[model samples]
Target chain A: MSAPIIAIDAMGGDYGPHCIVPACISFLAEHPSLQLVLVGQAPLLEDLIARSSIPALDRQRLHIHHASEVVAMDDRPSQALRGKPDSSMRIALELVRDGKAQACVSAGNTGALMALSRYLLKTLPGIDRPAMVTAVPTQTGSCHLLDLGANVDCSAEHLYQFAIMGAVAAEALGKVRPRVALLNVGTEDIKGNQQVKLAANLLQAASGVNFIGYIEGDGLYRGLADVVVCDGFVGNILLKSSEGLAAMISARLEALFASSLPARAVGLVAMPLLRRLRTELTPAQHNGASFLGLQGIVVKSHGSAGEEGFRSALRRAMIEVRENLPQRLHGRLEHLL
Target chain B: MSAPIIAIDAMGGDYGPHCIVPACISFLAEHPSLQLVLVGQAPLLEDLIARSSIPALDRQRLHIHHASEVVAMDDRPSQALRGKPDSSMRIALELVRDGKAQACVSAGNTGALMALSRYLLKTLPGIDRPAMVTAVPTQTGSCHLLDLGANVDCSAEHLYQFAIMGAVAAEALGKVRPRVALLNVGTEDIKGNQQVKLAANLLQAASGVNFIGYIEGDGLYRGLADVVVCDGFVGNILLKSSEGLAAMISARLEALFASSLPARAVGLVAMPLLRRLRTELTPAQHNGASFLGLQGIVVKSHGSAGEEGFRSALRRAMIEVRENLPQRLHGRLEHLL
Candidate 1:
């Protein structure tokens, strides 16, 4: 049995090939059997690959598929897909569709990646809409949050499906009987809007998934539940706000420790403990955005992701592939839907 | 002119009279002529006040009104007010209603505060509903965010009213021609739901307030606009999530700095810069939550507020009072409505 070929969208993200090339080398070193297909402007990728310290045989495992066009970060997803059919993002999706690559990964415009994935790989049977699942770090550990910016306007049924996909993902990550919760304004059944109230009712009645009641935004970081579910709009707000707030807080703490000599001494002594906590809180360290409910595994790394962040994303993709997450999700959701 | 008699909900908040008493003492120290009527459990308030470090003349400036009941943090605002008329929150609001106190402040159940404030003072004429306006720390400075958890479902007109009030509040803080923005998922005019779109259009056409276009969730902390307006649901999420993330990140950074010797050394040097940043980022340091669109000035401190946090809240209340914000807001919104 040969290794699985993973197509890497090379000409994407803030650091572009600099981060992607190093991450690919790191991944290949850890998984020597892994095959790599780099999709982007070939010259740039080659330049980056040449700078890496990986051996020739390992380099032989890498292939480049030149894509003349690249989608801008701010480009509309559907418009980009329609205009540039041969974009690195689109081509990477094609590789997966054609069985040349088992999965696709991009740190490009999220909208374009999601759109192209849906257009090329298509939604899995029984899945109404594909979801973007990502992990959020909490007090206990990491918890999976689903629909983290796909399907902005979700119906009660949509939320139910998200719970199923999220539960499957959580199980794959080793959380047995993953407690699924519908994110709402409050914990009470009657606390949210009409949509949340209806979703709560449906989630409660559903089986297989461990349907915990409502969890508020605060509970997301408290690690109250294993799986938190919501529509893309709310989830996106949560995801971005959480990330932004983390940055804001980090900045604030730095300022606080710098205020006085006494505080600086405290900060110096507390450095070890602070680093451990920061490692736990950094979102990039915990989860890569996974485009779920697609026929192929498509992980969307953060656009600003650097080498370490991209490495984490690639590692997440490897985990998803090993667990055969898509097949498991389809199996679980097929009959229920 | 006599000093305004302000009613303090003495039994409210996590630290209760312990923090509130000191906050009042500190506030009185600065504003010697200010009068206060403390309402709470009679014996408890008397004991706390007697033990307080406030001077004899300062003590003479305070009058205690005994109430036997208290509202728990988790209690529903409406239900709690109805069930406990003698609750400190209720008595404080009643003091304002009966003309015994010019204004009221509480660090109690937010829902209860809103409900009692409305039930007692009612809405200022032409102000459809009151909004919970709070200050958020931003890169540039602090910005006012209104409807921070008052009315969950707001009409376009209601949002416009919030904008007007927010702008007036900003002006009260000395920001002339404050840039007002309607909070949305995206900045594009066509983006967001019908409510947001309509609100944007209304704000753009409305007179007096300097209406900026749409501002996304990310724009809240960017200081892109002087006054950001949103429905209660989103506002609540933004406010609470900011607080939650701030705490989470602070804790995380502390752990990071303490993780190892090298990190601790780096942390020691970075301590002053970090402290300055943290002070700028801590929302508690800037302003208290204001019940805007009310007939009188009322600020709700965080329920978990300590002495310092309460002092900040009191300072914010003093500023609002000094600026004659409620009158200015009423003047602007009355003609527009």
Candidate 2:
């Protein structure tokens, strides 16, 4: 029952400790129970924290773990793995592997994050590879989408595994017997490729899952299902496309509001709701995309995220840590497999 | 210089002739120079057209080419191709092949439309397969996205050909050497799957292509590229997801507006612009997704589209006919290959 320790890769992302330290400080102040270990260059971490002027009580919960080297944004995942052994990303993951931290969060290179996470944490039993999952904002609420970019070329079994992990993960996010569906071109049984059809067959026969049949991309936004499963290739495009569309609509609305006095006056009242609407419709904007099926939680934040965005990632890590998501998946695997 | 004649599959889609016959009548009336042949059950189409009370002059331009059979909504593409030779979708396509119609438009079974079109019209020289391309509304304008749902599993060469076809199609829609990009998860050089990377290499090396590097899904909406190419699976999901997100956003806005009296007053002013916004952002709502790389033009409409949606499809077909899209693509093939 002791306070949970969440590790932050302080030197990750487009902006390093400067963007992340304040987020960690804010997160600690808001949640009195959780502790944070900022892993990065020692002097820089201490300096960033010192400049924050945090209250002494919250500051006590924040600790700095040093790693001399940093993983560059442009470094290849394999290169980052073989080289940069003492990098912040690697060290943060190691802390989780050694049980020093319940979870690790980073805003660095996605491939590097996935590679380091899979290499250091390994996969749960019955899981072939670790898939990335994120809570995509839907109309009614949110749905958990998986394999965001972890395994691009997934087999039917891999998809089935994602469904199980997604259903289990969705439950952790607060849905009972979450309706699981496959992301496909059409809802018809014959609409998709062989892999999707095979995955559908497996889901139908599974004992524990509430298989809801096939769902198209539109269904994802409409909140037709609580858990949507797709291979990394499809999932990545879906997420990125939604993000792009949301951004475009927001820009267009801003331009329209600015065009005329009446429009601008209306926009004065509408701007806040419209902005919230944009965020709600965008799946990727939800910020914390976690690598699922791993031995421990590793949430990937968007690079160049401001303080608010970085804090959202930290909040995501805290949720998984409290839910004990990995252990829950581990517990559910025997039945699903 | 003869007026173009478009063949319509009146018995196709979810609503069949009830939704299509009036659209064809309206199209003929709107464009004085173009003609249309309603290809469906003679008695039903004639009855509906007669009920429309069309003016005699426009009526002369509208003809009926009877289709004795119908393709069921749930019929497989292979089944429709082999079993229903006299079906509305097949007959419309045949009209193009026979030179009686310059182009064909259908809101029928997509698989059937694609299968029958390929079988009747065949692919152009150096073209592996036909792709579905639609004009998706972006913030600034619209971009032509290809492989909407024609080829599920595309090779690197297939993507390369899609780019060429998309570029040519975009020219038909009025863009100069449309900035072509491969649709990917990330814009980075090493972000996507192997096929995408290989396609990127081909596009980069090929002449006559205005390769603008890679574009993520968001770029598709931001109007970053004039032509965005992806495999059918990814493209379909992106389009459908956009449609769903747009619809949800519209519904939420409506609810917000109706929540109070002052909000309703603002809503009255904002409603028309917001309605246009919904249609503009949804790629699937554009109604006419044409099959590119064929020897003849064949456009597919959404199966359950209303009257206006059907007219949009007819309008798309007319554009293709005027542009002589097939001949244009055929002419461009030599330079590209």
lDDT of 2 by residue, A1-337 (tens): 6789999899988878888998889889899998899999999989888888899999899999999888899899999899899999999999999999999999998899999988999999999988888888788888888888778788999999999999999899789999999999999987888899999999999999999999999999899999999999889888877887878877887887788999888788778888887766654444778888999999888886778778888888888888999999999997678
Worst 10 residues of 2 chain B by lDDT: B279-288
Q: lDDT of all predictions, in order shown?
A: 0.79, 0.88
Instruction: Give stretches of model 2 more than 4 Å off.
Output: none
| All DockQ scores | 0.32, 0.78
A214, model 1: CA deviation in Å? Answer: 2.9
Best candidate per lDDT, number?
2
Q: Write the per-residue lDDT of candidate 1 for residues A65-120, one digit (tens) a residue.
A: 99989988878876777999778888988999998988888898887898898989
- Quote the lDDT for A153 in model 1: 72
Candidate 2 lDDT by residue in tens digits, B1-337:
7989888888888888898887778777789998888898899878888889799999999899988999887899899999987998898889999999999988888888888989999999999999999989887788888899888889999999999999999998889878999988778887888899999999999988899989887777788999999999998988898898888788888888887998888788788888988876655555678899999988888887888888888888888888888889999998878
TM-score of every candidate's chain A: 0.95, 0.97
Tell me the alpha-carbon RMSD of every candidate.
3.5, 1.6
- Tally clashes: model 2: 1
